[model samples]
Target: MLFAVEVAIALFVRDRFVRPYLGDVLAVVLVYCGLRAVLPLRVLPAAVLAFAIGALIEFGQAVNLLDLIGLRGNPVIAVVLGGSFEWLDFVAYAAGALLALAAERFIHR
Candidate 1:
């Protein structure tokens, strides 16, 4: 569900905020959900792992990982790996991770 919303925003949302910030936030939540689905990770660990993965990818974008590996020309890979870096993305990722953590605890408790 979150992944679907993220993809929809990616494909159609051209606004400055939604596509970038909200999409980034939801992307982290989606990753957290995926982690929980496959691994028996508790909420905090999973959220931390998800946030770390997002931060690592953001760093990768900062260093131009796509161009280094020669995949920058590929559109899909570019979208998946992200084409550029934004420091604001770190905030979004953190917000997402926290949202996921709170959501899990709320649902379980």
Candidate 2:
């Protein structure tokens, strides 16, 4: 359910002002994973799951899978995934993940 919301936000809000902030997506994923850690899950497993979800999103963009649901082509996702190789997206993802980690720490404290 959370994952579905993430994907829905990605598809619908990608073109909004936050479109360039891929970090926001990563941060959201991290927060979700962090909160889920309240269960018996380990951190590495949670991070891997988040990464896998991100990878799946990138692949979906690459294959235009979202188009089936009326999402227009977004060259940004391709670039973020290294098709065109924009370093900024990487930084954004890192920042987002770090922010999430920090937030998790604060919350857990």
Candidate 3:
């Protein structure tokens, strides 16, 4: 499952590309799939929501949200919220959204 893969990447991988970019891409997909599993979400909306969530988190990182909330020192929060911001993350999120849309179309056809 995508969650398992995300966990594995988070726990084990330290590469420059896979851990960051690929993980981000899969993250959006995971979010989309998760939303679909629980809610009556359409594919495009789910993907958009997923990308929005990730982008919001990334913007949070840009503003150092965890530190402002006094949670930067918390390891769990640090991991979940992340610490750095990158424009490429937006690209990865978009890619993930498109990939999720494509996969949904492929699966339903």
Candidate 4:
């Protein structure tokens, strides 16, 4: 279900708001859910891992890893790895992690 939402957002949403912030947020949520699907982890750990991975990806953008790896010409890889770095992406990732944690708690209760 969540994976579907992530795919929908990836394919459909392209406006400024969705592209810049919501994409980053949903990216983290997808990561969180993906990790949960694979491992038996507490909510906090899953969220932390998601956020950490997101941060690392953003850091990779700062260093232009995609260009170094010659994936800059690939649109799919460009979207997945991101071509540029932004501080707001970190905030969006954190927000997504918190939302994932809250949603998990709400659903469990």
Sort order, TM-score high to low: 1, 3, 4, 2
Per-residue lDDT tens digits for candidate 1, residues 1-109, read 7878987887889998998898989999999999999999988999999999999999999999999999999988887779889999999999999999899889989
- Residue 17 displacement (Å), model 4: 0.9
After superposing candidate 2, which stretches have Cα over 4 Å from the reference? Answer: 1-17, 30-39, 67-91
Report clash pairs, candidate 2.
none
**Regions more than 4 Å wrong, model 1:** none
Per-residue lDDT tens digits for candidate 3, residues 1-109, read: 7899988988899999998999999989999999999999888889999999999999999998998999989876787778899999999999999999999899999
Of 1 and 4, which scores higher on lDDT? Answer: 1
Per-residue lDDT tens digits of candidate 4, residues 1-109? 7667766777887888887798889889999999998999988999999999999999999999998998899988887888899988999999999999999999999
Q: lDDT of candidate 1? A: 0.92
For all candidates in order, the CA lDDT equals: 0.92, 0.53, 0.92, 0.90
Using TM-score as the yardstick, the better of models 3 and 4 is 3
lDDT for each residue of candidate 2 in 10-109, tens digit (9 for 90 to 100): 5676563365565445544655575566766565455545555555555565666656555445555533342322334545555555555576678789
TM-score result, candidate 4:
0.91
Q: List the residue pairs that clash in candidate 4.
A: none
Clashing residue pairs in candidate 1 (N, C-alpha, C atoms within 3 angstroms) = none
lDDT of 2: 0.53
What's every prediction's RMSD, in angstroms? 0.8, 6.7, 0.9, 1.3
